[model samples]
Target: MAEHVTPPGIDIGTMHPARRYDYLLGGKDNFEADRASAETLLKFFPATRINALENRRFLRRAVTFLAREAGLRQFLDIGSGLPTAPNVHEVAQGIAPQSRVVYVDNDPIVLVHARALLTSTAEGATAYVDADLRDPARILTHPDLLGTLDLTRPVGLMLVAVMHFFPDALKPYEIVDRLVRAMPSGSYLAMSHGTFDYLTPAKRAELDALLARSGEPAAPRGRAEFARFLDGLELCEPGIVPVSEWRADDEPEPRPDPAEAAVYGAVARIP
Candidate 1:
């Protein structure tokens, strides 16, 4: 682990909903409040862990593709949760030793863990920014990010399993638009979002209520709505699809499960 340098007045003891997500993922860095909230979430959606894992797998695959196939070397990972296995930097740098990565998140807990666990590869670079997604300008102009990446060139913008945190009121689409505008042409936006397309109306209602009680905003959108986020962008081959079915590994196909994990994965390039 690296050194822990938390921003001023940031406390990890008091739990937040995102922290609870870290707890539910079997991480040891979350507080009691987060644990309680995670328990409540699990009671309503028992497949929450599976959903999270699948989303994470999607993130890894996207990063790998960007580095190995797309010839991209810089990455901006917004709403980065607590550092987990095969993080963006790890996957990208593993493919190309010169890859550079900048992780952005407002959670102090995530900051602490990111500083302690996310290390820059000897041939590359990695840094953490204590910022929120709502402040895209702050993220795009922050000294840490500017110093780490070159905005004049193409960079991969990863928003894995995080946009759902922002509701319609926050103008999540506009936020994405701003970031897209900031990046140069050929930049990629890889996103994995949660949706209720797979759930029954009653079950969706039950989960929505549970999230409200847990202080989380549910932003499950249909394919059309999700596609709007990439309105001016060029979607990569295989457009948006179920995460499990997105470029699945080359091996004997496993039996398909009927239960869908309310999540969609897609990668698009700015024109």
Candidate 2:
């Protein structure tokens, strides 16, 4: 892994979402800027680390369900953070070695680690697209993505823990709609998003003010608002719920409280 290698043109002083997420997940691929930002965020959202773990667990369960149960052979993982163990391709290909995955992220460091991620099972394939989630057109039309996976067939579209950064003002719903429109009827969308729905009004206000002051773009939404991204889709059992509770059999006992994590997760099939 070339994680220690600083990719050219990356700003080491600024904290990036991918690096901050890696920091939150107890990964050493982050710099001082990312750790500092995570510490500041932890001041308000004290359960930041637990939330990261719960969200990661949700991703594993959701991807396993998509690959093993839903029988999805191709995956498009938008906003895939720094290379982590049991990545989307690893999880999917483990269940079905023929599965193909295309990971999307604009982080330069993640792009550098693309070599490690691109290594797949002999029967499976993996590709990386160094693109921003904000640009749906670019992602949907990327040559790497097109070459790796066929959109006309069923695909497991993963937007896990990513949409919250894109507030309503960014036309997040429209971005999702465009991506969903390209998928076939049998395709599935699995996502997990940060939420303020479980928090007290005062706590939400404090977190909101803190983020505004810190210039963090995180916009935690309510369950209903988050579900808007899956509108017109067939919701899987256990419909939108706390990340820790979404198909949590694989998780150990003593799951974190929804109020503590405050992140919603769900998987819906495109009809």
Candidate 3:
């Protein structure tokens, strides 16, 4: 396979959502600009790191459930950020070695690191598509996506923590609908979206200003609005809750406060 090269037009001086997320996850792949923006966001939303961690945990639990319990063998993870430990392929292929995965992201930095996400078990397959989420048609038609995943079969559509980047003008709900429509029946939608429901009006305003200043404005939704994204699908048990509490395993330590997580997650199946 060819190595991914970063495009020349990327602006390293400005913060990108994926890089900011990496910084929040304590990863070293972020630049100074991303770190600065993350620090500012932390000032207003003190639970930024907690929210990121909980979202990641939700992703893992969701994928595990799809692979082991749901008997899913294919995954389409859009807006998959920089390669992280225990990635979708890792979690899924660990349970069923024949699983196949296609990861999609538009970030040039993520493209440069796509090789890391391409690793697959001997019995499985993994590929990456360099496309934006706003263009669902382009993403669905990408050669890499078409080659790796069989659209005729059921797939686990992983949309974790990336929808907030799409402003309402982008019709994120419609984009999700398009993707879900393309998948066959019995396909699953596993997603986690950021929400401002936990923040006060003052803090929400501060968050908006911080994002605007950083050039990465987001559209955090409320519970009802977030639930609308899964409209045509059948929600699994314990639907649409804070990330930390979504089918969480019993641990010796107390779970983090749901308010600190500030992100809603759910797994729904297309009937």
Per-residue alpha-carbon lDDT of candidate 1 for residues 1-271, written as tens digits (9 for 90 to 100): 2344546665655656566666766777666667776777678878777777677778888998889889999999998888988899999988998999999998877787799899988999999999989999999999999999999999999988888777999999999999999999989999988878878889988987876775667678877888888898899977888776666675236712324456888999988
| Top TM-score prediction, candidate number | 2
TM-score of each: 0.92, 0.97, 0.94
Q: Assess candidate 2 and give its lDDT.
A: 0.90
Indicate whether candidate 1 or candidate 2 has the larger TM-score: 2
State the TM-score for model 1. Answer: 0.92
Q: Write the per-residue lDDT of candidate 3 for residues 5-101, one digit (tens) a residue.
A: 4467678788888888888997877777889888987888888898898889899899999999999999999999988877999999999999999
lDDT of 3: 0.89
Clashes of each: 1, 0, 0
Which regions of candidate 1 fall more than 4 Å away from where they truly are? Answer: 1-17, 251-258
Ranking by lDDT: 2, 3, 1
Error of 2 at 128 (Å): 0.1
Model 2, 92-192: lDDT tens per residue?
Answer: 98999999999999988889877665689999999999898889989999999999999889999999999999977888999999999989989999999
Angstrom error at residue 161, model 3:
0.6
How close is each model in CA RMSD to the real structure?
Answer: 2.8, 1.6, 3.0
- Please give the lDDT score for candidate 1: 0.83
Alpha carbon deviation, residue 250, candidate 1 (Å): 3.7
Pairs with backbone N, CA or C atoms under 3 Å apart (clashes), candidate 2: none
Each model's C-alpha lDDT?
Answer: 0.83, 0.90, 0.89
